[model samples]
Target: MDIRRLKEEIITYSQEIGIDKIGFTTADPFITLKGRLLRQRELNYQSGFEEPDIEKRTDPSLLFDEPASIISIALAYPSKMKTHVRGTKTDRRGIFSRSSWGDDYHIVLRNRLEKLEKFIVERYPDARCKSMVDTGELSDRAVAERAGIGWSGKNCSIITPEFGSYVYLGEMITNIPFEPDTPIEDQCGTCNKCLEACPTGALVQGGQINAKICISYLTQTKDFLPETYRSVIGNRLYGCDTCQMVCPYNKGMDFHFHPEFEPDPELAKPRLKPLLSISNKEFKNTFGKTAGAWRGKKPIQRNAILALGHFKDETAVGELEKVLKHDPRPVIRGTAAWALGKIGGKRVKEILSEALADERDPDVLEELEGALEKLNHETKA
Candidate 1:
C-alpha cells in the first residue's frame, strides 16, 4: 500500500463526510503536555473532569499497541444564533455557551471518527485504531495542535484560521505511519484580552486556567458554588465564553456550514423562571440532545436561580420561594436562598423568614440564616 496514496484517500473521504478540517501527526509521547499536566496537578488547577492517570493520558502507546500516527478532526459550530429570543425584564433567560448550543458534540464527533475507522479497516483489515472525544484520556487540544489542526491560543483553545475557536475536536490513534503536518505558529501576540476578561481571574496567565474558579467548570459542579464566585458567573447556565469571546482571532467568526450545529433559541437561552420547576422528563426532552444536559437538571436549575439573582428580577421571587421551600436537593434550596437575598424584596424577605422557621437541613438552614442576615442589613440601610 502506498502510504501517501492512503493518506490522500483519507483526506478526501474526510471532506466527503463533512469534517471541517483534518490533520495527521506522529504518536510520539506528548512531552510538553506531560509537564503542563504535572504543573496543573501541583497547583490543583485541574477541573477533576480530566482522565486522572497522567501516563495513560500522554502516552498513545499505552492506549493502542504500536501506535504510529494520530488523526485529528475539527467540526465548526455556529458561534451566533441565527434567530434571537429576546428577554423581558420580568422574564429573564439563562444561556448555555456556544459549544453546548447544538447537538452534543461528543456524539457527533464520535460518529465521524467511527466512519473514518471503518474506511481504514476496510482498506487495511489489520489496522489498529482507537478514537476518542473530549472525555478521552488523551487531550483533544494537544492532539489537534500536534496534528496541525490549529494553534493553541492564549485561551487554551485550538484556534483555526478558518473556524476560529468555535470548533469541536476529536482524534483517532492508529498504527498507520502517515506523514505529520506542521504545527501552526502562535498568533496571540502581546494580547491579554482573555486574561483580563475572566470574571474570577480563572485564566491565570495567557494559556493556563484555574478551572476551580472558572464559571464554566463551576456551573457543572453539583456542590454549592463558592461565595466569592457565585455572582461572577452571571447568567451562564453551563459554561463561560468570556475568554473565547475576547480573543481577537475569534472576532467576527461565525459558521453555519453544518445544520447539526444550529442553535435552538429557546433551549440555548431558556427562560429562567420556567427552568426552576422543570420536570426531569421536560428537562431531558428539551435539553437532552445538547451537551449541557450531561450533568442532568440540578446544576442547570441551580444556575438559573443564580441568574435570576444576577438580574435582580423581583418577578422571580415566587419561583425562588418555591425552590427554597420545596426543592428536595439541598444544593438547589441553598442556592435559591442565596439568590433570593441578592434579589431582595419584601416578598423575598417574608418567604425567607417563613422558610427559616421550618427548614431542617443543616446546610439549608445555614443558607436561610445567611440570606436573612443580608436582607436585614438591606432593610436597615
Candidate 2:
C-alpha cells in the first residue's frame, strides 16, 4: 500500500467532510506533557476534570497496541453570534463562552471521527484506529500541536493561521506508519496580552494555566464560588473568553463554516433574571443540547445569581429573595444571599433578616449574616 497516497486521500476526504484542518504525527509518548501534568498536580493547579492517570494521558501506545501514527483534525466554530440578542437594563443577560454556543462539540467531533475511520478502513481493511475528543485521557491540544494542526498559543489554545484559536480539536490513533507533519513554530513572541487579560490571573505564564483560579473552570463547579472570584467571573455563566478574545492571532477570526456550531442568540446570551428561577425541566428543555448544561442546572443557576450580583440588578432582588428563602441546596441558598447584598435595596436587609431565621445550614446562615452586615454598613454610611 502507498501510505503517502493514503494520507493525501484522507486529507482530501477530510476537507470534503467539513474538517477545517487535518495533520498527522507519530504516536510517540508526550514526554514534555508528562512533566507539565506532574508539576500541575504538585502545585494543585489542575481542575479535577482532567484525566487523573498521568501515564495514560501522556502515552498513546498505552491506549492502542503498537500505535504507529496519530491523526489530528480541527473544526472551526463561530466566535461571534450572527444576530445580536439584546437585553434591557432591567433584564440583563449572562454569556456562555463560544465553546458552548451550539450542539455539544463532543457529539459533532465524534461523528466526524467515525466517518474518517470508515473512510480509512474501506481503503485498508486492516487499519486499527481509536479516536477521542476533549474528554479522552490523551491531551487533544498536545496531539494537535505535535501533528502540525497549529501552534500552541500562550493562551493554551491551538492557534491555526487560517482558523485562529476558535477551533474544536480531536485525534485518532492508527497502526499506520504515515509520515508526521511539521509542527508550527510559536508565534506569540513578546506578546503578554493573554496573561494580562486573564480576569483571575489564571494564565500563570505563556502556555501555562492555574485551572484552580480560572473562571472558565470555576463556572462549571457545583459548589459555592469563592467570594474573591464572584466579581471577577462577571457575567459569564459557563466559561471565560477573555484570554482568547485578547490574543493577536485571533483578531478578525470568526468562522460560521459548520451549521452544528451556530449559536442561538437567546440561548448563548440568555436573560440573567429569568435564569434565576428556571426549573430543572425548563433548564433541560432549553439548554440540554448545549455543552454548558453538562454540570446540570445548579451550577448555571448559581452562576446566574452571581451574574445578577455583578450587575447589581435591583429587578432581580425578588428572585434572589425567593432563592435564598426556598432553594433546597445550601450552595444555591448561600449564593442568593450574597447576590441580594450586592444588589441591595430597601427590602434587601429585611429579606436577609427573614431568611436568617429559617436558614439552618451553617454556610447559608453565615452568608445571610454577612450580607446583613454589609447592608447595615451601607445604611450607616
Tens-place lDDT digits, model 1, residues 93-123:
8999999988899999999999999999988
Q: State each model's CA lDDT, in order.
A: 0.92, 0.94
Candidate 1 ranges beyond 4 A from true positions: none
Q: Could you give the C-alpha RMSD of every candidate to the true structure, in order shown? A: 0.9, 0.7
Cand. 1 Cα-lDDT: 0.92
Q: How does each model score on TM-score?
A: 0.98, 0.99
Which tens-of-lDDT digit does each residue in 252-316 have in candidate 2?
Answer: 99999999999999999999988878888999999999999999999999999999999998988
Model 2 — which ten-residue stretch has the worst lDDT?
80-89
| Candidate 1 lDDT for residue 160 | 98
lDDT (0-100) at residue 247 of candidate 1?
88
Q: Give the TM-score comparing model 2 with the true structure, all chains together.
A: 0.99
Off by more than 4 A, model 2: none
